[model samples]
Each structure stands twice: as structure tokens, then as C-alpha cells.
Target chain A: MIKDSTIKRSKVTLSNKYKNIYEKRFSSPLKRRLAVLKASSSIVSLGKYVILFGLSFIILYPIIQQLAVALRAPEDINNPLVLWIPEKFSFKNFEISMIILDYWNAFKNTFKMSFIVMFLQLFSTSLAGYMLARLRFKGSGIIFALVMFTIIVPQTTIELPLKLSLTNFLNTGVNLLGKSTTLYLFAGLGMGLKSGIFIYLFRQFFRGVPEELEEAAYVDGASPIQVFYKIMLPNAKGVMITVAILAFVWQWNDSYFTSVFVTDANVTLQTLTTKMMGISGNIQSAISQAGVWQLFDQDVTKNPLFTSMILNTSGVIAMLPLLLMYVLLQKKLFTEGIERSGIVG
Target chain B: MISKLKNNISKNTKIKYANDDELLKIERNIKSKLAKYHEKCEKLSAKYIILAKRKQETNKGNVKRIINVSRQIQRINTKIQRLVANLNIVHEKKFIKRSIVYKIKKKFSEIPYNKQKIVWGIIFITPWALGFLLFFLPPILKSFWWSFNDVVPSGTKILVNFVGLKNYIELFTQYVIDNNNIFNVQILLFVQNLAIDLPIILIFSLFIAVLLNTKFKGHQIVKAIFFIPVIYNISIISSTMSKGFGLYLENNTTANILLTTQLTTFLMEIGIGGSFIDIVIGSVERIFMIVNYSGIQILLFIAALQSIPNQLYEAAKVEGATKYETFWKITIPMVTPILLTAAIYTIIDSFARAPIYRFLEYAVTESRYGLASSIAMSYFGINLIIILVVLGSLKGLVFYYDKR
Candidate 1:
């Protein structure tokens, strides 16, 4: 959905340096207009690249703001405008944010979920798509049609069935007002089930793969799994990455699942987004909610622990890794690629 | 087997019947009539036989005539027997009526498992399933169901009681606890969204998209800047918005911000100070912004332009057509599809996450999830209707290149 204007900038990157030379040869008004047309067309090619470059800064602003906040001393959290680099820098807020979030465990949990979902999605979607695309089975057409239809079913439609199924299986009591384990059951790989949508994308990519390649391999005496791994999967590296990157970012920002599943002190970054509005902050509301008005109001900037909780936990720590990673290597992260494989459906 | 079926079909004609009773009724009536006719014929035949014997004794000519009449009577008897058998076979078994009902039931049963129906179910149902059930279902429904009949604030009753759609009806007609209008909040939201955000998103996205489609230097760089806001974390952006930082320049006024002459911003504030100076400044700013962002529209124009084929323009030029003449004749009709698609998408995104919904969401925290759900469902319905109508109007007008 990047606006098509971003694509147009490619036209400009083409050289306009030879204009005078061309002008001499094509001096007539008709020829001049045609020359201008070619130049203009070349300039238009720069559109997409320019759109991307411009979009980068706008996209990074929030993260950049977060970085600025994190770098500030705990005392400065309340200040709405931090105009420049702080007089005194402190890494203490990072420490507080990390401990509050249980960074290592949360990180581990996130990684575990992302990887598991990716594997489940790729395996399920590919195998299913391959069969739909290739194998001459009676219900193959029905199955392909089934997957395509599944693609459009908004995630909300299956929420009740999914929640009920998860709760019954896990036997974990539901959190009526907050996130529960039920949200993550089949959303991410939970050392158990994986997301259904991931399977759909993978299967689509697999379906586009030609049948003759697999058949030729079969004639040479390879098993189905071997054909997939060596012959097919290896060839579809680009689409696999596209799907993988999509899965990673999607699960990384798994706000809905986390919001529904885990409503506790152990809120992940994604779930924290859902919880934000609930933690309203007017000075009066804060003091009333804190259960210590005078103390909090008078010296939030003074107290170490309170400052840490507010500044480190809310402002800085939540976005630390994402901010760092995006700033450092977002290009690589989103670029997950081996080139546009003929494999992409 | 085919020959036997044909023979049987030829033998029995009265097969189209719903039940045994109707077939039997017709057969019984036919059988009685045939019997009456047969008895009459038999009586005639006996008379004829007796006459023939008398005639044989008296006159040889009379005997021959009586025998001929007797033979005719025998043929009639055989035909009546065949008719009776045919009637018996027609009413013998259930065929037509039972089969009709059976076929109807079979068709209805097949509907649930039909592949196309299942696909439609998945596509239409998934988004709502996730929204309603997983995201808001258990909580909203429980609350809606519980809103009626006091929860016996007495805690002594450890059981949650079933109240009905009363929570729903009461929302609009009365309050859950007191008399308040659920329709008020829903109506306010409906009005604000339709009036403001939908139009803003549609106008801005198209304008920006068009501008980005240009042949300007560093145009791609500029496009990336605008789009970046979309992919930025909602939480981060919202937080930034709440903090009173991202939206404003150093000053709250548009004049100070547009001092840099960012063409789009400057033109947008044309009437800001409400004078001729401001208007002139605004128009120039608009032009600059257009030229700057023309890269995007230029790009789309290029695509739409490229899609038109140069042969068209060359032919037009050859025929001495002006640029304006060529443009109206070519560009507008060709790009209508893309424009429509963009409009629909922009509308969905703009209103789906509007500030009104954000504000109303807080009311949801106070156990107003049902009202929230109703509002959401209603909004989604309206969006669907608008999209369908706009596109539906253009459906016939669409010149599908592939179809052609």
C-alpha cells in the first residue's frame, strides 16, 4: 500500500546531464517536446525510490522520539519538550525498562513464538499449496478453493471459536477483563499450534511453483519431502523470506493476541499498546491512582524507584530494542530476500 | 436393461404421481369404469353367441354376422384388461411426489458443504470473527447479557444470571441502570466520522498519491517521508500525538510553520490569516507542493499514461489535436478504476482509526463494550454500504482490458 507516488520518483534519477547535446540535435519544437517527454519519463522512474526514502524518516520519528526520551535522565520524563541532547546522559533508564519488562524472558518468549509460527505457517501452507497445485487428488480443487476463501475471512470472525477452543484445550481460566493465554494458543507457535493465515500465504506461494519440476525430481527417485526441501523450498527463497518477514513483523506486533491472552504485570511491548489508554494520565488521575498523591506529586523527579517506573518502564524501555534495531538495520529486517523468486504467487 | 425399461415404460403409462393415495384413487376410478364397460361387452358377447347358435339352426347368413360381432366384443375385453394393469402399475410404488421432496431436502443439505458457499463464509466471516469473538466477543457479550437483572450486588448469589437482548434494547430505549440514550453516542459518532474523516482521508490520499507520481528530483525521498507515518507504531504515534509534539511546529499557528514554504502546508493555510496576502501565499504554496509531489501523481499518470499507449498521443498529434483535447479524451476514462480503488481504501483506513472511535473507546472501559460493539458493527456496516454503492455505480462503466 505504499502510495504509487513513491514509485514515480524513479523517473528523476535518470540523468538529465545530456539535455544540451540532445537539444542541439532536436531543436525543432516537435522534437523538443518529444525530447522533454523522454526526459520527463526518465525522471518519473525515481518516484518509488524517493517515496521509500522519504517514508523512512516519517516512519522512524516515533522511535527516534523514544530514543531521545530513553537517553534523558529519569527527571526529564515529565518534560514535554526535550529540545536537544540532555546535559547529563544516563543509561540507568534502560536498566529499569529492561528489569520491569523482564527483558530476557520476554525476548525469549517473543523469539520462540515468532520462529514457531513461521515454521508452522511455512510447513502447513507449502505442503497444502503444493498438493493443491500439483497432486491429482479428488478434493484438490475444493481444498484450493477452501484456502483462498480462508484468506479473506477477517481475523475477528473466528475469534469466538478460537477463544473457546483454546480455553478448553489449555484449561486455563479466562481473564474476563484482560489478556489471557487463550489469545496466543494458535496465534503464535506456542510449543503447540500455529497461525492459520501464515499457512495460507505459504500455500499460495507454493501453488505458483510449476508442477513439472517436482514431477521430474520424482522420476529421478526423490521422496516428496526431499523434493520440497531440495527442489522446491530452496528455489522459493524470496517468497519464503517475504512470508517470513511478514510473519515476524506480524507476530512481533501481535497486539491483539497479547492484549487478549496475557493481562498481567508481564505485559509485552505489543500488549502494552492495548493497555495504554487504560492507564490514563492527568496529574490528578495519576496521583489518585498512585494511592500516594503528595509524595508522588511533590517528588516524582526525586524518588529513584517511582522515577524508574514512570520514566524507564513507560517511556523508554518498551521501545528500546525496536528503536535500536530499526535505526541500525531496518533495511535488512524488511528486505528479507534472495531476490523476487518466480515463486511468489 | 435399456430395452426392458423401454418395454416396461410402454406397458405402463400412468407414472407421474406424488403418492400412492392419489395414484390409487385414479386407478380405482379407472378400474371401476373399465369393469362396467367390460361387463356390458361380456353381456353383448353372450347375447351374440346365443344369437349365433339360433341363427346356425335357422339361417346361415345370421350366424356369420353374430360371430363377427362376438370377435369385436373379445377385442374390447382384452383392451380393458390392459388398461386395468397399467393403472395398477402406476399406483403400485412411490416415485414422483416422494422424489420431489427428497430432492429438495438433498439440495438444502448440500448447501452447508458446498465449496463456494464455504469460501464465501470464510472471507466474509473471518474479520468479524476475530473482532467480535476473539477480541471483543466474550467480554462484550457477557457484559451485554449481564447488564439486565441486577447481579444481586449481594455477592451471596455466586451465580451469573441470564438476562436477554434486553441489554441491547435498553441501550437504545433506556439505560442499563438508568434512562440514557445509547443512540446519542452512536449518532454523534456516525455524524462526525461521515462528515469529517472520510472526506479528509479520501481527498488527502488521492492528492498525495497523485503528487508522488511525478518526475521531480528526490521525489522518492519525499514520498518515503509521508508514508513513514503510516507504518510507524500506532502506540508511538498516538503517544506522540497526545504529548502535543508531532502535529505542531514550534508554534500552534500555521503561518509560523509554513514560513519554510512547504508548498502543501502553505497552500492548506491559504485563508489562515483571512486576507489577500494569505490567499496569494497559499496559492503559490499549493502550486509548489503540487509540483514537488507531482512525482507520485506523475507516476500514476505515467502508469495510466504508459497504459494508454504512445501510439494514441502520436496519432492525436498527427491529427492536430491539442494536449488538453488528448488528455480529456484519454487519461480520465482510463484511470477511473485506479482512482476508485484508492478512494475505497483511503476511506476504510481513515475512518477505521478515527479520533472519534479512539475517544469513544474510553467509554468502553466503563463497561460500555456493548455500545462500543454496536457502534463498531454499525460503522462497519455503513462503510460496507458506501464502498458497495460507489463501486457498484462504476461496475458497468469499468472497461476490463482482460475481458476485452
Candidate 2:
């Protein structure tokens, strides 16, 4: 309002436009903008809210659909009304999907796989990122550049190479050196869940942190290694959590590389998603309340339902990490930070 | 792991960590070549810039025709600038600022050997060198040899013989590519997907991204609904969809469009007077594919949208620009980088998560290993071609190696 009035008044006093107070309005745009923003803060914007909510339902709908199907008897999964809420809820299929799939074992394997990878990832990425960021030692910059360049290479292109080593290298463990070995040593690191990308992101983020924090520690008689552990690492909690969640979810849902890698060793666990359907053969009857009666009536492969039931249990087991991730990092899961960190991958 | 890292660390250190004297000579050789290139570029760019300005004034097809010529000029100018900077680096034996912009032009020759070592490594080193050797280099190298050579499958192990690139040769020439250079079923699935899938997703994603990123009604709700699909496994959804939801949609026009291009022709071929039959089937199949992969494009678009600073639009507004003008001028140019990003992701994605991959996976586990590898290799080749083509220079989008 003041600027508008001043502009009109300046035109009237045409010759000496700067005679009246004029330096205050236009200098420092940020201050002006901030003031304007404060005045209009009550407008209550809602753009991102609607989008996240709507997209969440779409993301949630499939899992919700699967859950509803698992909850009802097998036959009712197809019934249209099951989309809303099942007419009659029975715990048979959930019980079976849990029991027959050896879900406990699958959960153990999946979590074991997730935590092992997560620990390696967090440790390696933090150390590497710290080394690149704070330590200005020789060859450090070269290592940093090498990490950045890996960001663009198509991962699937690497799939064949990764797959070949897992099945051949570990299985036989021999090369031109004739180093014959065993124990699937590679349980092997990758194909899908990329820790390499995490290192790049962590490094970039850590680089942004003020060098004074690390420097101050060094001046106070702390060693380089201590600076990394006590100062730099503790400060890097946000990225660590984000990356840990991302790695776990990515590994859990993975369909491709894990299939190639763990095929021989953990055949029971690696194909957990596919094996859920495998154990509970013809889930068509696992759908409705009436379907439960039909399941027991049928002369299917009925062995001891204990060990066999564990197979169907893996499906429910698989959903745990994602659920845990959502529950934990719900705020960071759907925000701008993902775009920044996720781009490194 | 430390031992492995040590082992995987490049064995070619003889080339990388060469003696200082030898390294200095290699650096000199590179700089001089760069200088000559730059000198040529400066002259060419001036001439092209003049021509382009004239063409623009005239407003003709000459503008597009002169694009390559002008680009060459730009490249040369950039080269000349680099060459001039190299000369300045020699004068300042002890550097305050290593930035090329801060350097003056006559010192190219005298920069010390140790300083040169760091710069050479910075520009030429490959970060993925470790990953490539560990993940990609070995097995793919073996696969390159294996795929070509015949490995007669035995019970558990296979007998191998070198077939002299026969597998690689047959991938394009024999089994897949028709006599006309068009790919067959295996190669066609790989090639045609990107052809159809990329443009459709790119367009739709941009549209949705613009909407989702906007300040509108229920934006969070919309975004959440869309992103929900990302977490749910595609194979599971696709499997479940195909069983019921997809089956129901199979009788639609869209599915029919995918199945048979011409409905009347399909009906006539099937001895029907008129055809709703084919139309229904094609439409449903298309819908099924959309449901399976819809999550990916949305994610890519979201990433692209988030990168674009809101201030660009605000600046446009301050300049008395309309919303439409702001979109065309600021938004399009800002997001063109992401178009390249999306193109790469979509190509990679179609090969990885698409229905065709599922089909190939099914074939592989069923012990049709020959056919499965053939399909896998064929897809790999097609995807490789696109990546090579798009990334002709490894400089599609200048990622913000942002300091802060």
C-alpha cells in the first residue's frame, strides 16, 4: 500500500522523485518478501497435502486389497463387495497365508538379509562420505568423482554381470587362480539394493556440513578417526535413517537380482513372494467363509500342517519391513528430501 | 570386504599411478591437443554465431539447418576457453584458487607435477570403476564370451566351446531381426516397448506432475494415492489384476486396440459382420499394462517436478508474465533436463519391471533357459543401444554437484 501511494505521489512531484523517503521500499528483496509472506501467512496453503493423501490411497490400495483378500476366505477375494469390507470376516486365509508359507523363517531370512545389508551400507557409506568430505588427503577428490559418475549407469545393464558372479563365482569359487571355495561368500551384495548410490548421497550431504565442526574436534586433541565417529557420524543421523529405510524396502520388494543371487542357498527365502502363492496352492478356495469348508474338504497335499504351513506364512512376513519403515519414517518418506537423496541412487 | 576392495582396486595402477616425469608428458600432450581444438573452435564459432544471428533476423528454416553449425562453433569456443586457461595454469606455480575462471592465460607449461596429478585424476577417473569391476565387469565379460560360444547344457554343469561371437551376431541378425531389420518377438518386445512406452509416460507424467506439484484441492491426497502403488510390488498387483480386474477389462475397446489394430478387419477375419469383439480385448490388455507400471512414471515426474524451483515461476510473474507464458518460458526449459532423466529411467524400467520381463522370468524358471537367455540378451542389447544413443556424451543433464 505504501509503495503504491508513493509511486502515484512521485509522478505528481515528477522532477524530484527521490526527495521523499524512497530508499526503504526496494532495497533488500528478501526482507520485503519476508514481510509480505508474514502478512499473508494466514492464507493456509493446501496443494501438497491433497496430492500426498490421494497418492497414498493409490499406493495403499493394492496392499489394502491384498490384506482384505487375506483376511476373508479365499473365494471372497474376487467378490466385488470385498473391495469395501468383507461381508463376513474370517481369519482362515490369514492364518494359512501365515502358517503354510513358513512365514517365520521367511521373516527371519528377510530381516536377516535387510539388517546385514543395512549395517554394511550405513558403515561403508558413512566412512566413505566422511573420508571424502572432511579429510583432504591425496586421491580423495578422485574417489569422490568416481562415486558421482556411477549415478547414471543403468542398473539393469549391471544385472547380468552381478547375476553371473553369484551363480558361478560363489557356487564354484574358482577363477584363473584356481581358488576353489564355498559358503556362498557373496550371499552377494547386490543387483537391486544399491549401497554404492548411498555412499555418493551421504558424501554429498556430509560435504555440505560445516568443516569447522570436524576441525574443532581435531584442535581439541581428537584424532581423525574419532572426529569421524563422534562428530561427523552423529550429525549424519537423518541421511542414515533415510538410506536404511530405502535399502530395506528396495531389497524386500526386489524380484530380479535376489532371484539370481540366492537361488541355490536360500531357495526357501529368496523366492518368498512367489513361494507364498506356491505353498498355498489354489488359493481360490482360501477366499470366502464357505471356501474354508471347501479347503479342508479337498484332498490336497496334506502333510504335517506345521512345517508345510510355514511356507504360506512368508507373505505376511514380507510386509513387515515396509510397515515398519512407514511407521518410523512417515514424515521423511513423502517429502522433498527423498527427491534430493533419491536422485543419488 | 577390505581384502576384496584391495583386490578389486584397479590392477592397472601402472597406467594410473605412473612416474611423475611420464605423467607430466601425458598431461602436456592432452593440453596441447585441447589448445589446438580450442583455437579451431573460436574461429568456427564466431562465423557460425554471425550466421545464426542473420538467420534469426530473417526467420526461416535456415535456423534449424544452422543448429549443427552453430553448435560446432559453441563447442570450439568452449575448447578455446579451456586451452587459454591451461596456459594460465603454468604461470601460477603455487595456486591460491584452482578454478579455471580465476587463472590467467600464460602459465600452462610451468604448473608442477604433483598439482597436475590431482587435476588429471579429477577429470579422468571413473568412480564406478570399483563397482564396474566388482558388479559389472567380470560376469558380463564372461557372459559376452559365454553368450556367443555354445555351452551345451548338461544335467548340472554345461560343456562349453567358443562359437566366435555367434550368440551376439544371432541376437540381431538371425533369430530376432526380420530380413527387413525390424526386430522379431524377443527383440521387438524390447525395442517396441520404449518406442510406445516412453512417449506415453513422458507426456502423461509431465501433465500429472504439473498438477500434483501445484497448489490445488486435495493435492496431498492425490499424491499419496499415486505413490501408494510404488510400495506395493508390481508383480503381485499385476498377478492379482490379471486374475480378476484385468480379466473383466479384457472385453473393452482399449484392450482390443492393443490386440488388433483394426477392429473391422479383425471381425471380418473372424467371420463376424461387425466387431466389438476385438476392440474389447485390446483395450483391456492395455489397461492391465498401465496398472502394473503406472507407479514408475509418476515417481520420475515427481522427482522432476520437485527439482524445479518455485522462484522461477515467481520471477516470471514479477515480470508481468501470464501463467501460460511462465510455463512455456521458465518451466519447459527448467524441466527439459528431466526429460532426458525420464527417458533413461523409462527405458531401464520397461526392461526391468514390465510385463515382458515377467513373461521372460516365467520362461527362465520353467527351464526354457535357452529361450529365456535369448529374450534377456535381446532386451539387454536393445536397452544398451538406447543408452548409448541417448548418452552419446555423458553430459545429458548437468547434475547439481551442489556444494551446499
Taking the tens digit of each residue's C-alpha lDDT, what string does model 2 give over A1-345?
Answer: 999999987676644456332445435787566656655543424434543454455456556645544454444433444443567776765565554445667667666666665665565555555556555458676666555434444344344445545455546764411111111222122222554556655765676566688668756866555666688667666567667766666666765545545553235453455445443455533333223333553333232322222222334455655666565655565563445433321
Q: Write the per-residue lDDT of candidate 1 for residues B87-145, one digit (tens) a residue.
A: 65675654344456668756654453334333433433343234334433354344334
What are the per-model DockQ values?
Answer: 0.06, 0.11
Q: Which stretches of candidate 2 lie over 4 Å from their true place?
A: A1-64, A73-84, A122-192, A195-242, A264-271, A280-321, A339-345, B1-132, B153-158, B168-183, B215-221, B244-314, B354-378, B391-404
Q: Which digits, one per residue and each the tens of the lDDT, describe model 2 over residues B1-404?
A: 99877776655222223355654665587588876786677777676778777867876556655787877777776766765565464333321223343343225324543354344333322332333456555655555455555655568666667666565565456542224443355455557556666666676567667767766665555655565455556665555544443333334325345545565567678877633454344334454355445565665556556656678778878888965688777666666655666666666666555344553445445544434445455556666677777666535543443323
Q: Residue-wise lDDT of candidate 1 within A136-190, one digit each (tens)? A: 3455456545443333223332333344434443246543333333333334321
**TM per candidate, chain B:** 0.42, 0.51
Task: List the candidate 1 regions with Cα displacement exceeding 4 Å.
Answer: A1-27, A34-57, A74-82, A85-88, A99-102, A124-184, A188-232, A264-316, A323-345, B1-231, B244-404
Model 1 chain B, poorest ten-residue lDDT window? B290-299
- Candidate 2's displacement at residue A307, Å, is 20
On TM-score, the candidate that comes out on top is 2
TM-score of 2: 0.57
